[model samples]
Structures are given as structure tokens and as C-alpha cells.
Target: MSCTSSSMDIVPDDTFNDFAPLSKRRRVSDCSRSCEDSSCAPLKKFWFPDGDIVLEIQTRLLKVHRRRLQCSVIFSDMLHIPQPFETDQIDGCPSVALVGDALADWEVALAWIYHHDEFLNQVVTFDILSGALRISTKYEIPGLRRWAIEELSSRWPVDVVSMRLNALPHAAEAITLAQECNVPEILPAAFYALSVQKFHASADGGRSHLVLSPNDLRRLIAGREALQDALLRIAVDPLTEPGCANNAACAHCAPRRAEYWRARLAPDPKSPWSTWLVRELDWMLRDDAFAGTLCPACFHGHMSTIKWRLGRLRGAMPGFFLL
Candidate 1:
């Protein structure tokens, strides 16, 4: 029976050992048609003598309980399908080959199935969460996928307030991951973060154009230009507040704010991109000297106005990127 999560036909090969060095690992392609090939071996950790099924993944064979495999909806559905007249088997159990699935991801996802406590009690890295999400999504493991998405949502929030407080890591990868997993909620923040960090040459020194797909690159470019225009519009427009106690002071501050943004956004000869206005505004809010220039009432009022405008712009980020 076919039980692959991703696209591709399955081929099983010789011995599998998790502890083996990368250099010594073998591929199923390198083995002969017969199981008698010396290179093929069962993965010691996952191989169970009493297990009912042997999962062939590339060069490794993992014999696990059928019940545990059934936890995944896709696997469960596949298990119910009738077997062909001729079937592959390892030891005494039937073998199911999974093609085009990453062994590392399978390892992590399987760990979650067998050792749930380890993930529950520990802080999982981004790579681990990413792997789990991919595998669970591919395998239709709803519970595991939900847990991974929840963990990611905490880091990459959908709303403005939480987005401001958190710095999203792996911005480029996160964008692709969001699209792949159909997690549109995080796209705005992920795209915004990448735009702020400079897409051409990111803070990590990698070229974003090289990492992002053509469509994503186009969206990023368009969204970044929209952000620049939005910042200019906000800066040039009036910053009046009816509640301002000192209209005179507030009037002067408005021009100063516009000039501040203009100067901050001035094009640099060395770099074509400018800093994101949201980051600049965040810094301005914390600048005591800037705040000191206005009366307390005016300062708070103007700050509120700026925040409201930026918040609105931020909310439109998904559309800005055509997301």
C-alpha cells in the first residue's frame, strides 16, 4: 500500500543507523534490488521486533507500531486501503515506503508521537517547530500541527500591538513557511519584518532575492514602496489634535516631526533602502529630548495620533503585499 505524505515514489534500501556519521550513511538508490544487500539495515532506535509495519524512508527502515502511525489522519487512511498482490516487507511485517519526505523532519515528528513529554517540557527551537509543522501538515496530523502553529503565533503575532513588541526571527524562511502551511495571519508581520531588515542584503548577510520566490520578491518590493509612501504622507500631513493644551507648541512640533522624518528617510548614496518608519517612530516615542519639546498633553496626544495612523497602515500591510 502507498503511504507517502509527499509526492514521489518510494524505494527502500539497506541498514539505517541514526548514530552513523553523515559521511557513512547510505542511500536506497545505492543498494541492489534484494534485501540481502549488506548496506541496508534497520534503524536500531525505531525498529521494533514486534512492530506490525516497517516504514521505508530513503535509505533507512523504521519499524514502528501501526497504532502510532494511525494517529496521523493520512497514514490512517492509507492503512485502510487494500494491499496489492505483491508487497514489500521487512522481517515479518509489511513495509510502506514514504518518498520525498525529509528524514530529519520525520525523526522530529515521530519523536513527538513517541516522546510527547520531551517537547511539552522543553523549549523547542525554530528549526524543530518548522520541521514539526511541515511533517504534521504533510501527514495530516492536526494536533501536532496546531501545537506548532500556536508556538509560532506567539512569536509572530497577527495584530499590531503584539507585532510591535516582538521581533520575528527567520523572517525570510517564515514567509515561505507561512505560505507553505497556509498561515496567512503571519505573512504581514513576516513581510514587514523582512522589508524593515532590508531585503537585498538582510541583517544575516544573505540576499533575500535569492531566498524568496519570484512572487514573494515582487510582493516585498511593492509592499516596501507602499510603506515608504505611507510614511511620507503621514509625515507631510497635519498632526493637529483638538485636545492639545498648547496649540502653539504642538504647531511647531508638527513641522519638526515632518522634517525629522524627511531627514531620517533621506536616500543614502551607499544604500538604496531607507529605514522603516515604524522603527523610527518607535525610537521617537522613547526619545525624552523630543518629548520634552512639547507640553505633556500635546506630547501624549500627538503620540496617540501617530500610533493610530501607523496602526492603520500596519493593518493594511497584508493588502500592500498582495497577500
Candidate 2:
């Protein structure tokens, strides 16, 4: 993620525990509430203390500048309504009751609107970025929406290995957020990362909310099986040939190198291929001592073949995740 001017710490994992289905939160009536109410008082302390608009999002209240809300077409239209009693009022300022979104998400969105330079400068985490994307899209904030999408797309990996390395920790949540926010660009890599981790229909152990959709789960399972088979076939191909050196180097080290490749590409099904294998192969290719184990002709031949095969595998990977 790129930072713009000011930044905040990404929300921690424990913080996400505060997020529950909207139905579970206490619903605040959209009727008028006195600003003197304890629940409504603290929300008045946001930037721009004298802003004309207050948004009661879930249990939290936010004071926002009317000019800032006008930057969004949706908000602009919403704020233009002249019917005063039709909306909630606090301290004589119009209060828009925004329901069905988490307080954390609203905070991020409002922060971007009021303190954009600072928000942009901070290093955003997956959770914060996804929240911004959701709110921006909902409010028709085109600029912020585009920034969120670009940040996500830039961080999303193009290959399975890179995806596994960078996205595996949060693959499930990322996939769900991408789908909800209409960000298809992150799906391929996110899905592939999930596939590599081995799709499990019951993986979330009945926590369906934390799992992918049934259709996506099926696609991941099929793609993973196909990729594993292709990788095994490429890795286990015969390395010895009639014209190759028949000396001790060929007889001993060649088999060991071939075995190494086999173990990496086709590990026990319980211990499937992972980023470690990719890193190991990369190191072997670069280390002079490892490369010296084989004769010059055989070494170059095997390296070239492996490189070509891996390239093809990577090229074909994206298609496997297509739904």
C-alpha cells in the first residue's frame, strides 16, 4: 500500500473482533435525539467542531463538514433535502443516520474526508483499506474509491508463489471483501492463494461467515488439484539421458538433485508444495556451489528446463482461478 501524507496504524486483529453482523448491534431510532444525551455528546469532538452535519453511524456519532460531504455525489444529493424533521437533529445540526455499517468503517471513511492528507500518508492495512473501499463505494466517493482499488490492486500478487507469500494470512477475508466491494482484480490472486492453502469445504469449521462462497470454494478445489498435478508432472520428468555424462557426478549428484526437485514439487499430499519450495529452488539456481554439483552441459540443460517449466506453470495459474 502507498502512503500519501499522514498515516495511522493498521487496525490489529483483535480490533476486528469488534465487527459483528449489523443485525446484532443495538439499533438507534432515526428520530431526533438531544445533543446533551451522553451517547451523542462525545461524537461532537471530531475535526471541524463547528461542522454543520453529524452522522450517527451505529452507536457512534461523527461531526462532518457539509462541504466535505458535498464532495460525494450521493452525499451531496442526500444533504440537499430541505425536509428538516425528516432527519435527526443534534444541537440544531442535521444528523444523518447511517445504518448497516460498522463503526470502525465509518471512522475510517470520515477520517479520510476530514484528514485526507494524514490518512493517505499512513500505511494502511488490509482491514483499513477494505473499509475505505466499502464506504467510498457506498457514498459514491469516486476519488477515494479509486485510491482504495489501486492500493489493493498494486499489493495483490500476480503469481501463486507471491500470493502465498503476501496474502495467505488474510486470504479468506480479502476474498470476501473483494467480492463485496466489486474489486475483481484481487480475486484471481486471492483465490489462487486460498487454493494453494488447500480448499476445505469445512475449513472454517462451521464459521461460514469466515469462508468463501460455495461456488468460489469449488473453483479453488478444482484449480488446486489441477495445478498440483501439473507441477508434479513437470518436476518428476527424467533428468538423465544417453548423451549426458556417465561419470560419478551424473550417477550420484544428478539423482540427488532430481530427488530434491521432486520432493519440492510433489511433497506428501499432507505437506503440499509451498513458498518454501519456490525459495529453495531460487537459491539453488543462484548458488554457484549447488550449480557446480552437475556437469556444465547437464547443469545448464536442467536449469533451462526447470525455468521454462516454472514459467509455463505460472502463466497457466491465473486461468485455473477463473470462475
Model 2 poorest 10 in a row by lDDT: 1-10
Write model 2 residue lDDT over 128-169, tens digit each, in one string: 888898888776689889989877766666554454355555
User: What is candidate 2's CA lDDT for residue 229?
Assistant: 69
Which residue runs of candidate 2 sit more than 4 Å off their true CA positions?
1-33, 37-48, 80-88, 198-209, 238-256, 266-288
Tens digits of per-residue lDDT, candidate 1, 51-95, equal 887666778878799899888876676566565434444565666
Q: Where is the poorest 10-residue window by lDDT in model 1?
A: 16-25
CA deviation > 4 Å runs, candidate 1: 1-39, 82-86, 164-168, 199-205, 234-276, 279-293
lDDT of each: 0.66, 0.61
Question: Whole-model lDDT, candidate 2?
Answer: 0.61
What is candidate 1's CA lDDT for residue 126? 76
Report the number of the highest-lDDT candidate: 1
